[model samples]
Each structure stands twice: as structure tokens, then as C-alpha cells.
Target: MKRVVALAALAAALANSARADSATSQDLSKGYAKFSEQGGQALYANVCQACHMADGKGAAGAGRYPSLVADPKLEVSGYAVALVVNGQGAMPPVGRMMDDAQVAAVVNYVRTHFGNRFTDAVTKDDVKAARP
Candidate 1:
């Protein structure tokens, strides 16, 4: 009886440990996916190029379009979703970019691919939190 109890306890402990590990793995995967840079690039080309132009190089004359790619602030601790959703200076607010998930995807794309080494990917929650 004593041996049986000990074996049962050991099995239960192992099962609990495996469950905890599975949960941890899932959490990590979700966290990593939030920063998919390719998705961010797609968002940029489709939505941002009209103003900023290709390669994130803003127009010279009138300079109406602000540079979107390869920004110094790309390496900043916070996600750029706030500024993307909210207009700054002459940039207009995001109306079509209202889709939070799409915005995060695009932001991650730009931040990762545009000559910037930043690996951080924005999440839908991040965009939602900073939404105006």
C-alpha cells in the first residue's frame, strides 16, 4: 500500500510538471508570434507607401509624406502602434488601419525588416491599448 501511494504521488507530480511546461510553451509561442516582421512589411507596402513613398524615403518637395521606414525610434522600447494609429505632425490618423491585428502585423514587419535590427513584434492588444 505504501509503495502504491508513493508511485501514485510521483506520477501525479510528473503529470503536473508536464502540464505546466505545456502552458509555458504556449505562452512563449504566442509572445513570439506577436512580433512577426513579414506581416508588418505587408501592412507598410499596402497602406503607408502612398504618403511615405517606397523605401520609407519621404518626398523632397513640400515634404508632405513623412519617412516611415528605417526610423531611429524603431529600436525604442515601446511599440510604434501608438503613433501609427494616431496622427502626428502632418500625418493623418489611421481610418482604414483601424484593424488592430493588421496594424500590429504591419508594424512588426516594418520594425524587423527595414534595415533595423529590432525583433519586437506588436500585438493586437498593443494597438488596442494605444488606440485613440
Candidate 2:
């Protein structure tokens, strides 16, 4: 009887730990959903690939193509959203082609898919705030 009770207790503890871990992961992102990530990927495919290349290596010498992945403030969607909207160097202002939601999606995509540390996904409001 003692052994059975001990085993049950251990199992309960393990289950609780697993649930806590899941909650922690979702909470870490502050309610950012996986669906938003997909939107971000679509935006990147549509708007960014031409010059920066699909992998974001960019071209040599000319530097007309900027590195969209792992760039200045790449880990933060807010900073990236600002640059995408305002434009910099050779990058044309993307706000002309995309709205706030689209901008957030792209920024979130690059920041997350490129292995950067943007924990929470970007939102339309984030893009609006980043606007110059």
C-alpha cells in the first residue's frame, strides 16, 4: 500500500510540472499566438525576398539589399516595425505597400523565424506605435 501511494504521488507531481511548463511558455509570450506567426511568414515571402534573398544573406558590394534577419534591434518587433515603416538606407518605406497589421506580421516573422529572441509576437498596435 505504501509503495502504491508513493508512486501515485510522484505521478501527480510530474503531471503538475508538465502543466506548469506549458502555461509558462504561453505566458512568456504574453498571449502571442502561433497563427500570427503564419501571417508574418506570408508577409515576408511577399514583400522582402527580392533583394535580401530568401535566407536574408543579402548581396555583396552594392549593399542595396539589406539584411532583414538578425539586424539592428532584430530581436524586438517594435524596432523592426519602425524601420520597415520608415525605411532606411536602400530599403523603401514598406508602409506604402502594407498596412499596420501586415507590418507586424512581417516583423514578427523575421524576428522569430530567423532565430532571434523576440519572445512575444508583434501585433497591429505594435506597428502603429512604431510608426514615425
Candidate 3:
């Protein structure tokens, strides 16, 4: 009986561990942690840099990721917001995994970085409006 009880406890522990791992995997699969608390720069490095590159110049060869550096497309905040939220060809709608605040943060970060000097900020409200 003790052996059976020990086996049951071990099984329960394994099940709990599996549940935790599954949750972590789901969060990563969604482009990043759901509404992750990380700041814009961190988010960019963790998520966007894989495709867009660390310098934001983007990459090619395997795929054609556009350069964000001094791109005129970022002049308008709304356009960037929409693209991030809805995505364009090749780029997935990564913003779907982010909340409005997270979306705005990463957008604002990109707009301000990579040779971009756009002063205007993308508010969370703008992100919300851009969704769907």
C-alpha cells in the first residue's frame, strides 16, 4: 500500500511539472510571454531581433525582413501600429500575443531606434484602436 501511495505521489508530481512546462511553451509559442512585463528594448531583443536583427536593419537570404532603419514608413505612427498589430507579408501578426501596452511599447521603441527620430509616441489607445 505504501508503494502504491508513493507511486501516486510521483505521478502527481510529474503531472504538475508537465503542466508548468506546457504553460511555458504556450507562452513562448505566442511570440513572447503574454503581455510580458519586459520593457520595449528587452521585448525587441527577445522577439523582434530574431528576424529584424539586432541593429534593426533586418535580414535576408532565408527571408526578407525589411529594415526599420530610417524607413519613411515609420513617419506615421498609425501605420506602424497597424502593421505590427495586423502584420504584412512574411511578418506574422506578433502583436496578437501582446496587449495594447506591450504593442505600443515595442512600436514606440522601434520608431525611436534604428536611425529613426520620430518624436511622436504610440499610445496604448492607438494600439487598441489598431487591433482587428
Candidate 4:
């Protein structure tokens, strides 16, 4: 009788542990769903990293990707947003590939990081407005 009780208690404990594990797994899944990079680093990795390089310094040559750092054109956030959304000259409208939030992130990222130090952040609303 004592052995039976011990086995039952062990079984119940295992069941409770399984339930706890399942709950923790569900919470982790929810956390992943909510995750996003507001800093734009992730979006840049997926989109701009190839052409712009990780440094944001850009490249020059046959198809010159202009430097995002210390560029006079980026003085206005609107100009950068417009260029990203609409494309200009040699660059394609790569900004169209991203939604408003992603666009805002990358624009804000470029404006603030690298050698550029423009303080104003590009909002998702600004990205939406730039869309054509």
C-alpha cells in the first residue's frame, strides 16, 4: 500500500512538472512573437547590409552606394525617407520592401548610427506619409 501511494505521488509530480514545462514553452513563444528591433539593426541586416555594409559607410565603384555617414543630403529626415521610399538615381526603392515600422527603423538607424549624428528620429507615420 505504501509503495502504491509513493508511485502515485511520483506520477502526480511528473504530471505537474510537464504542465509547468508546457506553460514555460508557451510563454517563450509569445515573447518571440512580440520581439522586434526598433533600432533597425535587424532590418538593416536583412535589407541594407549587403549594399550599405555593416559600417553604414557604403561603397563606391561601378554602382556607387553613397556613404550614409556625414552626408549633407541626410540633413533632413524627409529627404532620407523619400529616398528610401521612392528611390533615387542609382538606388532602387528598397524601402518599399519594408512596412512603415521597418522603414522607420532603418531610416532612424541610418540617421543616428555610423558617422551620422542627426538627432531627429523618423517615425512610422513619416514612413507612411512618404509612401507613394
Please give the lDDT score at residue 2 for candidate 4.
Answer: 100
Summarize candidate 2's per-residue lDDT along 1-132 as a digit string, tens digits. 999999999988986776578675653212222222236766676567766778976777744566656665686566677778888777888654677777877777787765466668878887777777
lDDT tens string, model 4, 91-127? 7787766678888888888877777789889889998
- Which pairs clash in the backbone of model 3? none
lDDT of each: 0.64, 0.68, 0.84, 0.76
Q: TM per model? A: 0.61, 0.62, 0.73, 0.66
Name the best candidate (by lDDT).
Answer: 3
Residue 9, candidate 2: Cα error in Å is 66
Tens-digit lDDT track of model 3 for 1-97: 9999999999889977865786767544322345454568877987789899999988789768889999999999999989888988978888887
- Consecutive 10-residue window with the lowest summed lDDT within model 2: 28-37
**Residue-level lDDT for 59 in candidate 4:** 90
- Ranked candidates, highest TM-score first: 3, 4, 2, 1
Clashing pairs in model 4, backbone N/Cα/C closer than 3 A = none
Backbone clash pairs for candidate 2 read 40-105
Candidate 3 error regions (>4 Å): 1-37
Q: Candidate 1 at residue 106, lDDT? A: 67
Task: Give a tens-digit lDDT track for model 1, residues 18-51.
Answer: 6578675652222222322235555576567767
Sequence-dependent TM-score of model 1: 0.61
- Show where candidate 2 strays beyond 4 Å: 1-38, 69-72
- The residue ranges of model 1 lying beyond 4 angstroms of the native Cα positions read 1-38, 77-79
